[model samples]
Target: MHQQGAQAYQQTANVVASSRERESALLMKAAAGLQKIKDEWPDSYDDLKPALTFNRKLWTIFAASVTREDSPLPHDVRENVANLCIFIMNQTREVLLEPRPEKLEVLVRLNRQIASGLRGM
Candidate 1:
């Protein structure tokens, strides 16, 4: 038998599946918007920033919701997409000030690092 999280993912598959028809597109859209922010924005925060973290259900829902085409691309293509999402978000918070700034290679690197660091903890 699957664990609660896996079982939940299965049960909610229809929620995502049914909503995907309408919100999947929206999630795609939202994901694109986040990508745009991530891509074009800069890290002005310099000192302190928000970090990305995931709660299990939310991660399950987020992972379950999108198809392959979304921006940030739902890393479930590999594993633990929610953790990746949190990592990126936290890294983004680290490098970026987020009133709005342009994207940088540093932001991507920082995001990656933060995600990687998170897995260790």
Candidate 2:
């Protein structure tokens, strides 16, 4: 029984690891696309554009908060749930624009895996 439990854990971890890579790639592309929109029309896109434009810092904070799915956040955290997926994609784009592509890629993967995992239920 113990070995079975351990195997299950290992398998779950492996699944998560692989999923992370897939998620990251999707996020990077989404984020970049959103950023391009914002850059092309700063006046047109609202501050909420996920492509890393006006509210990158704020978006990052929100993303990090959601990433901590188990944490207790401020009352306002729930307010941002309307476009969570879009935001994730935008965040991916934002992170990919950085000089350190490897690190950003990792983040994108993690976000993607999380998003994918939740879609089932």
Question: How high is each candidate's TM-score?
Answer: 0.31, 0.32
Q: Model 1: per-residue lDDT, tens digit, 31-96? A: 344445455445423312322222222334554554345544435543555556565555455544
Q: Output the lDDT of residue 2, model 1.
A: 57
The TM-score between candidate 2 and the true structure equals: 0.32
Candidate 2 structure quality by residue, lDDT tens digits, 1-121: 9999999999997786665555445545544554445455545344323434423443455466555757454546444542564565565565545433333344444444544653432
The true-versus-predicted C-alpha distance at residue 32 of model 1, in Å, is: 4.5
Give me the displacement of residue 66 in model 2, in angstroms: 11
Query: Using TM-score as the measure, which candidate wins?
Result: 2
**Model 2: clashing residue pairs?**
20-109, 23-112, 24-108, 24-109, 31-93, 32-93, 35-51
